[model samples]
Target: MLQGEEASFFVLCDGKTALPLGTAQDHKRVGEGDTGPNTGGMGAYSPAPVLSEAVQERAMERIVRPTLREMSRRGMPFQGVLYAGLMIENGEPRLIEYNVRFGDPEAQVLMMRLGGQVLDLIQAAAEGRLDEVSVAWADDHALTVVLAARGYPGRVETGVPIRGTEGLPRSSVQMLFHAGTALQDGTLVAAGGRVLNATARGTTLQEARDRAYALVDAIDAPGLFCRRDIGWRALGPVQDAPATSQPT
Candidate 1:
């Protein structure tokens, strides 16, 4: 056993991606480029525009519904949320795995998209009234980027001074949520593998991506690094776009 008592793991099937096309990637490390051993997820985001509603509906029919039925038949009676991690390999959706809980960075993005009534949705799920609850997504697309410690998933140097978080426009559709923050003598300090989630909601995925990167620029931390091309794979060509420019 890998002794994941303090951690959690999920099983992903290769064929799940083929049901109704969607692509997802896991944040396997506390740093960039899949380097180092896995941590509790430095961050994640999803609903790549390539994953159309038709595809997601197919996944619900072919994968999620059937899996739930099978689990119930086997007496498992799974009742919590399911994270179906997936990836597109050679234009085909492949199941990366299944997670029993919400993905970290992914959760932040989803929650931001879910907006004000998140508590209500959870309650409905718990009460088996999911049918009665309908998700009203904002017309805008959203993205979340994570900031982590330098040596995260390992021995990290904490308590570093962080700055440049004030004066953000309140109506700018951007939010900075604290994931691993601690107050030491009334000063906010980094405390975990992933520390802050900078999220933005916009009229489209490209717009959301633009806003997200803008928020990243406002932060002044040398130890922080975020994937500049978060939703690029799904949103389509932004290869040569400048980091500070807003997408149309």
Candidate 2:
């Protein structure tokens, strides 16, 4: 198993200039306590603690910028979201993988924390005008919990009836994003392994985590499971916190 925190950045590169839109961390395991086989992503939270301001600077200076420069040098000229899966050891950041696009649940949390003209930024990058675009990020924490069908990352049972989805918070700070779902006979049903994303934002990471999990618990879907400890590593050890969601 790969034991490292992920540092994801929404980069706006225009062949020469590479601008970062935001950073986030994704929980990729299928079980709590970080056990079980790897799924696409079980949950995610924005502004990972592992990627501090200094660490982000190092990543850009040593990793992202150079990569963009080399790509341009080779006439590739990449644009769009550049996700860097990183491994940090002894306070040093190392590259693990470079995803050309945004990771699944990672996009859910990042969109909640980012402000300004998002579409404009993306267009600017794609049009090679990234140097003219600036990003405005909110001083808030966001989290997302993925509700997966039974036997997910394996043989998932789909088409099951899902309930309690009619009434969930739908503000700029809290909402749900549908993933693998469909309507059958005019009824919403689970259509894939990862069905829904319960997402929320707050002033603190714990607040966001709590709000996201609350939504997860509210969904009365049978044969569906989600990791309760979505932001456990970022929240650290809480005194007598709910034991149902122990860190993996």
TM-score of each: 0.74, 0.91
Off by over 4 Å in 1: 1-46, 89-93, 169-172, 235-248
Among these predictions, the greatest lDDT belongs to 2
Over the stretch 90-166, how does candidate 1's per-residue lDDT look in tens digits? 33334556876667767666666766676776666666666655656556667777777666656776786567877
Q: What TM-score would you give candidate 1 relative to the actual structure? A: 0.74
Colliding pairs, model 1: 12-97, 17-93, 24-86, 44-105
lDDT for 155 (candidate 2): 91
Write one digit per residue (lDDT tens) for candidate 2, span 1-248. Answer: 55655566557677777887777888777877678889899999998888887887888888888888888889897777788878776557788888888789998898877743778888888888877878887789999999888888899888988888888888888889999999999888999989999999999998998888889888887767787778888876435544444322
Candidate 1 weakest ten by summed lDDT: 2-11
Range of the 10 consecutive residues with the lowest summed lDDT in candidate 2: 239-248
Clash counts for the predictions, in order: 4, 3
